[model samples]
Target: MSGQGWERRHAAEYGTTAWSRAVVSCGALVAHHAGYDRRPGAVSEAAAGFRQEWMPVAELLALAACRAGQAQDRPVDDVELPVLLGWADGAHTHLLHTGPLDGHLGPAHWLRLAEDETCRSRARDVVTTESTLAIVESRELTGGRTSTPARALRLGARAAAAQARGVGFPAWADDCAWAADQVERLHLAMQAGAWRPTSAHRAYAREVHRTLVAEPDHPPCPAGAVGPSWIQRVVRIPHVRATVLALAAQPAYAVAAPASDPLGAAVDAVVHVGMEPVSVLAAGLERAWAAQLPDRPVAEWELAHIPGPVREQIRAVEALALRLTVVLLDLWHPHE
Candidate 1:
């Protein structure tokens, strides 16, 4: 499509309406934060990116959160959705509740709100206290300890309204919806210890190696020791390994991975199709980096490559990726 056509498509697909613009706008903000254009082409690119990189992780979180919320009898709200979506945005922008948001809206506030006579009465009528607490806690934790139940509840109300009007739904909303179903799978996996850190690390390493070997041009290391070295490094740094595994296990990571793999994928899917000279050039550069550390972990390779501008871009992407992962994990595994 023409640039104008793409722009119109994006606006229509993600633009605000009376009831739901906030949620859609939040989704757009996520794309924008993740280095997407918030235009039609960019949305398509993000969709592609989401499919590759983030789908699995997002599916995990969505299924887990849904079950948790349902078990607790709490209704999910726009605030929580946006926070999760933002993490999936590949930008990891901090989602704040800038509200005409009544009084103080923090975790404590959410707890109090849940206990409010009116809220309790309402929740009792529609949901169980356990469910209400679960929802409130999920919102609070997802908000990074800054959001209140009142704000979260209000946001939920807004999302409901938006859904009613059919405004700002993501083109990839189906993927997100599927993600919700996947949460139950994740819970089951967790119960079975299928998501253990050791197992996750091994899987991630294998995937990276597989991707590297499959694309011979993108060899892992100059000497082909990149994979082993990456494993060693990750194993050594318990904290980093834990973080990496945790992130790898998120639904957004899997969702965004497909969309952002090779950077150009997102660009092509969202901005324009075919091989643009700029993207081809970027891909070449990425290949060169991969070749440099044929067996190194991507995180290390990213740091080792000293192109100042590229490093900065990587930093930005990492920051967003990290934030999104944190929010998702927090929601499902709050004690952790």
Candidate 2:
């Protein structure tokens, strides 16, 4: 298909009333590092599918671009979906939310790309996959605590957002420190055999344990009673909230791994917008508990070792964060 035709079709696909909201809402949620808003029947079906199905990161960025390039009458004809200007727009919003600007890049820079036809037309001529890739690859990984690609991307997004906002870039060191402290405390508790779940945690763990034993092959149903958001509600006690926030912020836990099917690889790296951090942590906890104390009663699960998955999960989160940063900023400042 011709470029314009392809963009038109892609734009139309996500331009429907329901999908547009899904795109925008998901972008906002991911930008803020918030998880699924899991009130009963709170999220629309379309949004649920978009998040739960793990759509490609590229397509999510594309849909956001389609929204930014959309006009009152129709979507922008020259808007290159692959260019991903829409996500940049969202990032710009995220930057604004972080703090006030001191007139660095200013609103004019974004306004030109968003409103000026010439600027939008210019994007098609200048933006290409290789060109965008070069920009992403050129960014130095700085200020991230982790050494993975996702950490690089997270830092990259922060840097780019800072540059775009024309403000002093803030460090994520505090974020890293806070996450580490929380994890370490949990580790120490586990080591001493003093880390015990409260009544709420145990109750939830029992339910999760039951679910896993009953259907070892069943996938999690995000809309069900034990859905992703259910963990958030159950684990809201004072001690667990920080750990949940730290884990959830990683974003990789929100990314579903590819299935064994041939086509699953395409969507494997897709980030689930509806995924709750606590849900991922709880899932890991549930699996570990189930594996260690399969026949033992729930009362005996406290003796189980600290989950091996925590280290891996933390690593994965950093890696995915970097990948997303690159994707989101690939075609950044296209008009420039």
Candidate 3:
């Protein structure tokens, strides 16, 4: 499918209401894959297979991420496959897409794709052997980390919790939150030297299975309605601010966001606009669009409906929206 098609498909499946959750899940996946595991064999056979075929499938995800205006614009690469899969896993928890290949695709499939003999051989030759320094240098420059199984579990749990909360079914939310808390405890235990890394993995897997078994059979929402109350509570403007503050407290976001970059400025501008009276805010939003995106219009940004320049501006607007969301959350609920 075309990029725009993929965006609409994803939005239709996931809903714009939960965009923040999707972005957070994606970021967490990147962190888990990069920080926790580096060995090629660590990836499951299915995941490896998906990775091998990622060149084609990834276009959909890339388009979706771009349209959503995620934090970074990292293109798909060997290092990114695992991360993207992680994000998809998280997204699945809340907005499960039941398409032609529903049961057939899962983490294992993607893992196998990555580790397929042909793909692995190609990766070794292209990345590990031909341009080893380039790969290493790129990782260094990007500050990428090796994937850790424990971190993956933790991230999975967190993503699940986020989705569950957004879906607003109390039973699912509680279950997901409990699962995440369990993973977090394991993480803490590992940090305190109370458990071995392998042990933590086993524990996490057990907890995940238990949570799945415990989950309510009923859906979180009506076929086409917003999720439970808790989820809505967590996603509202104030709640979003709280979540952002919590995220900022993490070492990653604190370190990654530059103080005075274009991203920061864009965020500031958005927050400033949002803070105005609702009427004023609406007018100012239009004015800002006219001033910054005059030559290129918003209509053009649509996948099929808009012009190329307008589409480009739409992409920029999405980016600005992400920055603004981050900034507003940070300012309204500043973390230590």
lDDT digits (tens) for residues 1-336 of candidate 1: 433443343245334221133333233222322334333444564678745543333222232222222323332222344333332221331121111212223434333432334422322322222224335543443454543333333223322222222224333333223333343443354457665434333344344323222312322344444453322222222223234445455764453242433221221122122112123224323433434434544533332222222223223323332333333353333464
Deviation from native of the Cα of residue 238 in model 2, angstroms: 24
Model 2, runs deviating above 4 Å: 1-118, 125-127, 130-184, 193-203, 209-274, 277-336
CA displacement after TM-score superposition, residue 183 of candidate 2 (Å):
4.6
Taking all chains together, each candidate's TM-score versus the true structure is: 0.19, 0.24, 0.19
Q: Summarize candidate 3's per-residue lDDT along 87-174 as a digit string, tens digits.
A: 3333421222222211234445445433344533332232222123223323442355532222212222333322222221221223
> Against the hidden true structure, what lDDT does model 1 obtain?
0.32
lDDT for 16 (candidate 3): 36
Report, for every candidate in turn, its global Cα lDDT versus the true structure: 0.32, 0.31, 0.31
Highest TM-score: give the candidate number: 2
Superposition error at 288 for model 1 (Å)? 53
